[model samples]
Target: MLFVTRSLPSPIWLNGLEALKVTGSKGKGSTSAMIAAILRQLGISTGLYTSPHLLKANERIRIGDRLISDGEMDASLEWMLALRDSYESRHSNDNFGAFEVLTGAALYHFFNQRPETIVCEAGIGGRYDSTRVIPGRITALTSVELEHTELLGNSAELIAYDKADLCPDGGTLVAGKLEDALLPRLRAYCALRSITFVEAAAEISELKYNSAMMQFKMSCAGIDYGTIETGLVGKHQARNAAVAIQAVWHWLQCSKREVEEQRFTRAVREAFKAVRWPGRFERIAEDPETIIDVGHTQLSLHAVAETVREMNSAKPIMLVTGVSYDKNVRGILDELLPIATEVICTRAYHKGSPVETVAALCEAIRRGIVWKSADTIEEAMDLAVSRAREQNMTVLVAGGLFLATEAFVHLSGGDPRLLQFF
Candidate 1:
């Protein structure tokens, strides 16, 4: 599977750049962003690579806080496609997927930029993920859940082990909040591999969040980061921030850099507050107070429900949602159906579940809920916004990433099909 990427001429995988690889069922993207933000805040040239961009392919690759320009991305993609074509012509039996090609292109772009550090979020299970080719000395597993059972495994421990493989021997592995039963097994796995394991849950305390922001106290590398506040809305983000802080601390340690407590604390505080990750409980509009959250998993949906309940307990909610075919649709619907007064079932342009399927499941779950179906996200958005304005209800969009992408593109007045790269 990795041969295609490995066979590229002068591949960036051999660049030997310092990297922090993050993998989990959730929070991996947020954690990767936070780590890059902290490094950038501390005067380090940072490159970040995440997956499933909300708007364009450029969002998947970043140098410091800015995304790669369209021209640059196109040039890199052209170069990568040429190399892929040349390789495939010689070896017709083996070829890489779009994600692998994109990963190679992102690494190539990063190599040219010569960033001091790079943070990569794994696209799926980490054992054979394309990003695993990077020699990342600092790795973090944000949270484990039952996901990609066909590729990873059925149990939580199996999924955790598959993700934990991202951490190399003699490197540092940071474990975020995991189930109580899974901790000892993770610890044993780390100990056996001679990896230094740090539990992020143990390092964070006094975690709290509301509609405005999240505040927490973190102690990492023997420094007390007192009273940190982040603009990212959700308690889960607090946990992600903790994992990122620890990963950054270990990254510095790996580079033989000493940290000043006050300066490091200030950098971490500012970086977390300033980091912006779109499609995670993001508010795209006003008047009716529209929010779009790309939480397809049951756990993430539950977090969405918690945040929405905290933000607008008194007002009615108009739920607009669509999930992918592979997701646990019933579990996702179960999390959001209770708080929603009106439901709009819609499908994104790519890999979205059928409107009929989602509406049927919604009906089966709660018969009293008023539900409607839309073949496209635009129609759904128009219908949801109109009804929300009429009844003074909040529009909450939740479900898969593709659905969020389509909704965001529509609400932002962009052509959804125009920027459907990857």
Candidate 2:
């Protein structure tokens, strides 16, 4: 359905957001949730708005770790429903779509509660995403990669421009370290707009113990905020944390010099643990140590493969996988196959993929990888785990989120916990 946001009145709830943060890229959902969790620990009422809910649509909007009450959601829905005609008329009978309606609903919830902060995940490309309409007191970009090419753009430069679109006047703009190709465009854009630019890489050094997280003091506007550890899996997470920490402290100056380095560090540590962003390389079941990652791009896949190898478990690794029509599956497999002991390909379109074609491709690329295919996600998962059981091996389930995650939950008795975070 058409869920229009612009035609609707700006809710009074928008006024309460002392700090507004937006997370971009594949990790947007997890990163945004983590930001909210940290603010909540400091006893600030925080609202979160994310998209493409896994199991239920209600999961899209949350306040302080809980889904909004049904009554509140329904009331908001009714209001949007009533305002539909006016929005359509304004757009020459065109109305807001699904994303806009939910975003408006979330602002309605957060603003009325007058939460200490709001953490938002950009649904599509940054520039045109419904969330961009909100004036972010602080904006953070996750590592941008090629995504939604038809809607956003085909090149990294185009995508970067789309991401930089969220940099409204007077808003502090934080960018995930731009890829070599996108960096020049992003920098130029920031200069043209006079947006306060914060690059994730310039801060924290990677922590020695876990190559995964980085510990660094965030210095903004001559203020130094103390260090905190990020538990996000990839080396990229260190970058994501840098963007988040900077944004948090940047907004801190909005009121009091209340948070110094020490307190800020402490709050971030608690926030990292409290943030239970799921699916991105999560070892949800450790007995067989099953892994689920939603790494759809070549860069993301490379990151996942590197981390799995770093885990250094003696257990021989077996991979369960899937992908999209546009994804570089052959290229991703080039990075993924070296570490895997065997490969099981599953058709995963949700609607499904061509199982045999996927299997054939896997076999051709890695001649002796024991490549095989299954008719459905469940069957493919069963085959992978069953083989792992026989070999006492480890299973890393990944491909597209639609393929690996759905399969992992189905074989694990279809648990609801899978959707709660990832």
Candidate 3:
């Protein structure tokens, strides 16, 4: 089960690469970004590698907040692809996919850059995620759930066990809250592996949020930080911040780096203010107050709905949603349909569940609620804006990351790749 094949000079590719692997069904991206931000603020050069880029492949790799340059990407991809071709020539049975190639390239970039720290987010369930190939010093799990049932497992505890497998032997594992049923499984796994398990949520309290920012206090890992403020919205984000703080603190300890109290506190404050992970409760418009959230899961959608309700009291909320075919559409709609003034369902400018199917699903769960179907996301946005102006409602573009990414590009008028010119 080697990721970097021996045919590709594995020693040069893997040696001296230490990482913090964060994996779960949700919040992995934001949590990794938060850790990278805090590390950078503490004056450590950091490399962050995430997945499912919104616009460009280069978005998956970064060094100190700068995406890998096109020149660097070209060079790395060329080298990796050549290695893949050579390896396949000899061993046809084993091959690499696009994600594997990209993951290797990101690791190469990080190794070359020699960042003091690297934060890697798993593309899927963590037991065998490509990011696990890195010599991770600390592992962080961000609220696991029953996802990737075919690959991970069918139950919550099974899924937790799969993610728990990512914790390196003798390495520290930090995690947020989990289902009560999964705790025993996690405890058993950690005890078997002799991994240090720290529950981050236990140290989190007084999580309060407004439209602009969330405020919370965290006292964890022999480091007590009071009244932390983050620009990331929602109560879940506060928990995520706590997880990031604990994970990074553990990394600091393992690396034997001293954290000056005043400087570290200031770094936490500045990191939250500067942290910018897009497509989660993002505001795209001002007049009608259009917002976008990539919360396809029921729990995440519930949090999004709660945040939107608290933010918009004067105006009714209209939902423009497009979800993937593989998602639990009924579960998500069941949580969100009742909160919207009207629902406009459509497909993003990418491959997904057809807009017609999504519309029908919405209709079944509408329960006399107002709803309509649009052929494309553009048309859906148009209809939503027109209706919002007519009815004095706010527009919430949600349900899937593809839809949210499309909305971000469309609203910003920044990327031509998302423009579907059919």
Candidate 4:
């Protein structure tokens, strides 16, 4: 697989690109976007690659604020297809998956653009993820949890160790707030591999939010970053922002770039203000108040539920949700069922759990929740909107990335069927 990437006309490794890889049970995409935003604010050309895009596959590969153009995507895909054919001709048994091809195409596109820095979010565990070929010197492990147990491990320590593989020997691994027991084991694992482990810490205060944005104050590494505001909601985002700042701080030091504290602080402030990541507590409508968040894991779903509870404490909520086939359905339902006055179970067009399955779990967990099932996200949205309008309740679309993407498209007056998954 490495050979295939190396065979590209302009391989990413050969281009002297500085890279940062983010891996975790959650918050990888948001943290990667925040890092790229900070670098761009510092006047550096940056490329960002994140998995499970909200709408189109092109959203996975971005240069600065702009997504990859159709022409660039087509060219890169064509080049990758030729290389894949040639490589598979010689090794007939080995075949490339969609994610591998997409990763290669993104790197190939970045190689042409020649960005000074590239930030990539690992699609899954770091040890076997496709983005591991980036040669990132600085890796950020945002909060760990027991997820992807079959591939990553069953315990928190094992999962943290699996994600720690993103950083190479002599590199830096900056971690977000970790559990007390797991931190020491992760730190020791990094020490064994000669990797510098930096735990990200910040004094976050004055955290408040409204319909439009969230505001907070952060002081990290003995420097006051001042008031930071972002469209992304939730206390977890403040933590993600802290991790992003620390990761970028280490990245600057690793690249031998001058990091004036005042200028860096200013960049962090501006980056948070401008960064816009969709489907993570994003409000797509306001009449009845509809929000879409792509939080599939148990921990992530709990966080989303907590944030929604905080915001709409006085109002009832209409929960329109779905999950992937591989997720812990009952665990995810346990987090959300208590908050939902009315539940609508729906499936995304790709890899979503059956609506009947989610509906059954909802009933088993907490009966009398007034739950209904829809075969598609569109139908779910229609039902949720009608019910919410009559009850004047808030609607939350969550549980999986694909379901959130489909709901986002439907809410934005677009065709959910047109959404791409890779």
Candidate 5:
């Protein structure tokens, strides 16, 4: 069944594609993936839709932990293109963008596959996000921060509204640890809408984490999910998982499904232990300990810094970093420079910030921070890894998610077509 919106193709395709939508400037992808993983472990057929795929576009849409196959994705795209052409032919002076078409295509494909549940991560803000068409039963807002100011607004409160507004009226809303200033607005929004609001941070206690795993206990709606362990490292992931656990529980409650406490606990533990959200603090190699994280913003990179600090490794930390052209290069560099023993600035093959531009910025702020510039990401990775091995230091390759894609390809010996935009 092809769902169609009156004015656009997306809203129509989203009909019956109900999901738990998660939105934020950061952590939403990980949070959504965690929710899907837990549900899948429960023997539920689950669909997870996330954004900015590191390798392939199909990676953005998954069924039961497997990405949509190339053949199926192609078929879905063909169907969507037909609808797009029909819409354009009938209505002049209007055309859909890539995301709008892709959203419709994803929903259409999911309709055919008919997963028992879906967890979708919104692209950009919520109210107008293409994924918003899903008519979500549960909404999750991860930490709100300043981002996409031109289109989203200039303040944190506005961004929070765009995200929090995704929560369905009279449905469930689970949130991560938000800024103090954002809480009042969110609380008022939930209260006005009669949303059953739960704070993920508040429900979590006895939190403990290491480089390899994070452990925590979450009490959701007075239901204590005993000690949960997630393979995802860093303190931020614990918070993300907490939000996912609460959101999934609330969604289950909405579905009126019978909940077996022991079974639920077991499923959650097993899922977290095996759940893998690639490019988020992913360890690519053992020698010199190479790591890659798709942390583009300062708020996101802070977690990376904190994780490195907590490690207290005897080895030094070397960084290979770059950013998208649209990102705040200086801000990201500021957060990274102090944490690195040495830095190699480079540009990804895509429409990244100019290599010379990043090199110049790094040079200006060097002070005592030894740094170098590379013409390409490969050169930078090679140099960083070589130096790291020689010095017995850990290598962190980070920046935009695109950089993560490149690093993953280079380190894993994956196909080059994985780098192509879908």
Candidate 6:
């Protein structure tokens, strides 16, 4: 509907508020960050907005790598509350969900700042996600994964349909190897919508990431090409970079006349290393080389499992995991169980599935492992972490990001600033 609700007194009209929306199951945060960083390097004022802030609510809004100030957040939130009241009064519709409110604030901030480009990350699904309200030049899918099954659907193809629904008349879709199950549906959607679809080429040969900064040189199929050296961890990250870089490169050719080739490559790489995303397989603490990946969906799980194998020579591992009620407990447990030596299951304390189902699934499929639960996440993770870090082991806090978020804060000694406390 209206990204800027009538009641919302949409941010003051501005000039050159170009937008790019990044939507998909995984890597949306990193992809959006990469795009924004690239645009910023090109000497353009860029605004980057992502959701459910891993570090702080402010992380959801940024003009560049710099976050919006507390004073700015307060002002924006106030404006949004007023808009919510008016929206309820006039149409009696809650167009702005909790996420929508933050998104609107970001748009307002960007609009006011008049950035040359704005890269927006969708909150949930693509079609009706709060961020979809804004018009974007190009739509990029990091990689589709089945998430929010109750809200999206049961199958991977169904999830693709929801995400594909966002490609409007003139917009183009940049994708990195759509999952086999979702390919047919995505093609049908693209054909029906009469939109251009570009499948970004992945260097499948680069099995395991080597070198602190390895150069990935691949040409996008049927599109102008560029290579990027991404420091972001995991093999999946290279694909994410390719998808984002292709989107930026394609968007450049579409919107502008002819641009210098050097400028294009430099823009994409100038802020390469400075783009920081905290909890995507981040090594928060290294005493035991314990890594934290807030990967929830199946695609993300596979990435985490693969990264673990890469790090420890495919060693068997112990995992501390919890998931939201909306995820497929069986699918998640199945994907991870093969790589797991022990699975300590816990519930996110959220409304989705119960911890009992997760625990039950593990015992049935996994051999020689104790399935345990905790009344609270703390108790569950406390037991899980204590067990995993003994020796020659890596403890993975996966499932829900909230599980990783909570563990991070608690392990750092109940630091309230973990939210902003770090």
Best by TM-score: 4
Global lDDT scores for all candidate models: 0.85, 0.69, 0.80, 0.88, 0.80, 0.71
Q: Among all windows of ten consecutive residues in candidate 1, which has the lowest summed lDDT?
A: 1-10
Pairs with backbone N, CA or C atoms under 3 Å apart (clashes), candidate 5? 3-12, 3-13, 4-12, 5-12
Give candidate 4's TM-score.
Answer: 0.96
Off by over 4 Å in 2: 1-11, 89-93, 202-231, 255-257, 349-351, 415-422
Per-model TM-score versus the true fold: 0.93, 0.86, 0.93, 0.96, 0.92, 0.87
**Which should have the higher TM-score, number 2 or number 5?**
5
Which model, 1 or 5, shows the larger lDDT?
A: 1
TM-score of 3: 0.93
The best candidate by lDDT is 4
lDDT, candidate 4, residue 105? 91
Candidate 1 differs from the real structure by a C-alpha RMSD in angstroms, to one decimal, of 2.3
lDDT of 3 by residue, 1-422 (tens): 25353434446535555678898888898999999999999998889999877777888899997999999999888878887787789898989877788887886677567787689998878777877777776999998876789999998888887887887789888988788777777888888999998888637677676665677777765677777777788777877888898888888888888998878878987898789887778776877788888776877887788776655467788899888788887787777887888888888766568877877778888755646788877677878888998899889988887787776676676552444412
Q: State the lDDT at 336 in candidate 5.
A: 79
What's the alpha carbon RMSD for model 4? 1.6
lDDT of 4 at 118: 92
Predict model 6's lDDT versus the native: 0.71
Arrange candidates, best TM-score first.
4, 1, 3, 5, 6, 2
Clash pairs detected, candidate 3 = none
Worst 10 residues of 5 by lDDT: 1-10
How well is each residue in 108-211 modelled by candidate 5, as lDDT tens digits? 67877878778888888887787776766899888888999887889998888777777767877788888877787788878898987788764667767656
